[model samples]
Target: MFDIKSFFKREVEKKLIDVDDYIFMPERVEMELEGGLLNCVLNSDGRVDIFYSKEGVTEVSSASRKHPFTSFETELNHGVYDDVIDDLIKEVSKIIDGSSKYFRRNKVLPSTAALPSKPPTDL
Candidate 1:
């Protein structure tokens, strides 16, 4: 009974950005967030894999295609949807705040601080 459209309408839209309907799996739901795809994949094992990705940066790909992903898991039962959503929000915040390893490697640092000590001395 996990309906993507219903979930977005009831759960995500006002709290998060209003994403266009783009559900990909019968057991999963997804939306565009912070230039990436925010996914909730409901596994047969009764766990949900919440993830974010910037690899397939397109609405169509985010909707219908596959790409490499980074994720964390959560329980799918009980009335813990709020807890799960909170954890997901924390994870996204960590990535955005540049505290996560993925963010360190993937994000472009605005400062020259991380650059090597030597620069091209010629012309």
Candidate 2:
């Protein structure tokens, strides 16, 4: 007799494992761009933090003490992690590349007021 319940359970477990490996396990990823370093960090609560820092600076101090040039936070879902991350990178890249002046004009910083009023749903 086929065990449907067991099969479904295994499938779900495998999906979770894949999500963990693809998203959570990395913890932090960095990319160096023309303007500075772009940092992405995954928090346990499903929030991803993307920030920018100047080149050659100590990541720890910049991340801890100074306000990031720009910061984006979004919840990562199993199937949408890749899109979410890519979108964030594009947004930050625009800012760093000087193609977008919206952030610069407003001087948005990492603060309660600067946070997105509602979680983004476009992903």
Candidate 3:
């Protein structure tokens, strides 16, 4: 059986993060076949924002905004469902890579629901 919880745990283990790390989001977040609403969540100590509708969770394509992944997106380099939680880890890695500036300047540290909370300092 495809257990979301177990799969998530496995992914975290694969990523080699502390259990206290920020809980970013879900595995197959925003599965288009499943209406792409993205079963999203945030820090381990925060609340999830569930977007619902009368019908149910709906598909959410990338809004036409200046997304962080502009390079990948503009070039159509990203695979499908690449913006959802676990999938977006690469985006987080990018931030971590350039932590010094964007992380604090943009004020995007891991929030409460963030799993395996991010380190206060990345040095």
Please name the candidate that would achieve the greatest TM-score relative to the true structure.
1
Query: What digit string (tens of lDDT, one per residue) describes model 1 on residues 17-89?
Result: 2222333233676677555666766554334466665643221111222211212222233333435555555
Q: Pick the candidate with the highest lDDT.
A: 2
Off by over 4 Å in 3: 1-38, 41-87, 101-123
True-structure RMSD, every candidate: 17.5, 18.1, 23.0
Candidate 1: deviation at residue 45, Å?
A: 2.3
State the lDDT at 39 in candidate 1: 70
Question: What is the RMSD of candidate 3?
Answer: 23.0
Evaluate all candidate structures by whole-model CA lDDT and list the values in order: 0.48, 0.49, 0.37
The ten-residue window of minimal lDDT in model 2 covers 61-70
Question: What tens-digit string does per-residue lDDT give for candidate 2 at 37-109?
Answer: 7666755443456665553332221122011122223222232344544554566555455645455656767
lDDT preference between candidates 1 and 2, better one: 2
Candidate 3 residue-wise lDDT, 36-112, digit = tens: 33343222332333231212323222322222223322322354323443334433344444545344665766767
At residue 30, give the lDDT of candidate 1.
69
